[model samples]
Target: MKNPVLVALFCLMQTLILAQSPTPSKPRILISTDIGGTDPDDNQSMTHLLMNSDLFQFEGLVSSPSYGEGNKKEILRMIDIYEKDLPKLNKHNKKLAKPDFLRSICKQGRKGNAPFSGYTTATEGSDWIIKCAKKQSEHPLWILDWGGLEDIAQALHDAPEIQHKIRIYWIGGPNKKWSANSYAYIAENFPNLFFIEVNSSYYGFFSNNTEPDTINTSDYYNRVIQGGGHLGMDFKNYYDGEIKMGDSPSLFYMMDGNPEKPERESWGGSFEKITYSPRTIYNQTTTLKDTVAFCSIIEIHLKGPKIEIPSDSVCFWMEIPYGKTIQKWPGYHLGNGDYAIRYIPKKAENLHYRFTSKIAEINGLEGDIVVSNLWPGKKHSTDYPLGNHWYSDKSDINLYDEKIQGGKTVLKWRNVILDDWAKRWKWLK
Candidate 1:
């Protein structure tokens, strides 16, 4: 006979461990930001990063500038604030990385964008990257480039062997424009590097299409972050108490779920495959919500082999763009079995439009009807690659040419509400 009480206690302990260990093993991350310069957005991004520091085993915070300004001291200043706030942060989650630990990882990278060739002498930051990548770890080192690629370029140039050990997520758009020369160089040479250029998708976090109550970065400061605590005060000081951390999506992708599965939806946004250049270009996948933010009209085109179906019952209802009334559009059969419907989004609030049929099922002759945003497609007036606006639209193209340096990648920003605010203010409650 077994001791009943002891068996019960052991079972309870196992359950507790499982509950506490809900978060997967932490990912290795190294943040390369250009704060204290042209834009103060990086300050907000860094604050968000520190608040979620428990999610990643931070490797380094390098000051890698593209143009106007970048200083390692600014990063240290934020870390000092984080040091003071650690006690409060620890109250919510005791496993947060210590301020001194983050301090030791902070280093300065390249001062500005590299020359057109993209190779300059390696610096302290580049060397640090090489060292971190070489260190034995099961997970790949995720380098979040909040600024230029000069330091990254330099790292790859010096140690070409470590390309597989690193995965780069570049917040490129305007940043790409600044680092055109270096970006071109990387694209031309390192065709096998694993990289994701975050262009328009990050803009979704601060888009005007969503409601202010949704707690996007646009109103997150006023609603949740402002009066929280030490972390709150530091965040306020960054951009005059505004929430414009466009770079937080990079961290978001790593936080909520497995960052490796970018194809599935999450708080950060979803991604889809693109034509593989030297680096695999993963563009941010768009949803119905992202339709209105980037375009004035949303179009749907469906095509399939000519089939027999109940046409009388099929109808679509969409919000009259920016209005309350719901309008329905009748599906028109275009000569063959092809079907088409066009509707402008009614509201800037959310995506709530769909096509419905009264029939239970339909017999198809050939294949599934392709549903896509036809308006964003290339017109007769456009070139092979199409216009740059489509980079953020529903139909986006992946590009890697040195001559065409306009669109890197466009992401659809999500109006996600996370618990960072609730945890920071938990003590008060």
Candidate 2:
């Protein structure tokens, strides 16, 4: 006969054994974030990440405040939808199937728009992130902080230990987002950790008036507008009577399509961006310019009508997978939350280090290998593009072993990118 105390100990050991099963494998990932929360580039960044999930493990997305934006709840809602779309991702693309852990993690908590029911959760972003990150040590979590440094900062404070367990990637800060802040929270807090931050708010896409009329031309109009290749092509297909402008795939595709706004109104938003390189610091604001590091440099310029500056707009990164077809073209800001763009080079520096799945050969388009034709390999391009290059383990996109039929899943413009933010909020447009 065994003693009661000894029996309890045996049960405890058995329970622990059952609890600690096989740990999940660490996955590579590609994270899209709105580092500078309010910037439109955050939207584009999210779309890119979603369309290219094959190249990334994409553990999850974290939203906060960056670039002056105050709140990021709505943005979090949108990403949650993408997080919930995992089943569809598995259905359409045979190359993927999200792990049960990622599937479960996405729903740890979320935000609601209808004010608050008191029973509903306000925001558990920081809490959700820390817990999930610690649970998934097998897959190196690649966290893309696109908005401000709110959730992440809180996350580090909550579970400082997870920092050492996961890889971190940042996309904003330098002038406004202090490097020392990140150092204290990241480098200092979690040593021997993987981290890469790109302050794209300055280096990202923007517009200027230097170029002449482009999309308005008769030749261009006829090619895109009339030839079924124009913005009208997507517009005609999407607006097939659904004028409510509700969230739909067509809406996102036509985000830049201005059936009414003439070509004379389109524009971009920045002038130049400086990336941390092995050695260089020429194209950045003076504040924290020399503090961190520089890796790449890109030209930027903004052109568009000003709107009622309502304090600030929040931004965040995307976690879904985006493919080459989606990353095929260049874009511009149409202002008033209505974006318009083209593939042609209009701005003076339009051709400077422009990266797209098309140019990068992400999906592997046979016979179209532009690797050699790129940089010194192709047309004798520069040796370095942005500078301090870094890839994330989570950014490793792969095909799943599920029985999913259909062709390679690609980004076929969905509604998240199109709906006018101002309209959704029922505010001024």
Model 2 Cα lDDT, one tens digit per residue, 322-354:
233222322223346322221111111212122
Off by over 4 Å in 1: 1-23, 211-213, 216-219, 276-415, 427-429
C-alpha TM-scores of all predictions: 0.65, 0.36
Backbone clash count, each prediction separately: 12, 83
| Model 1 lDDT tens row, 223-317 | 77766677777777766776667788788777767766655565565555433221111122225333232112233445545556544223322
C-alpha lDDT values of all predictions = 0.61, 0.31
Candidate with best TM-score: 1
TM-score of 1: 0.65
Instruction: Give the 10-residue window scoring lowest on summed lDDT in candidate 2.
Output: 367-376
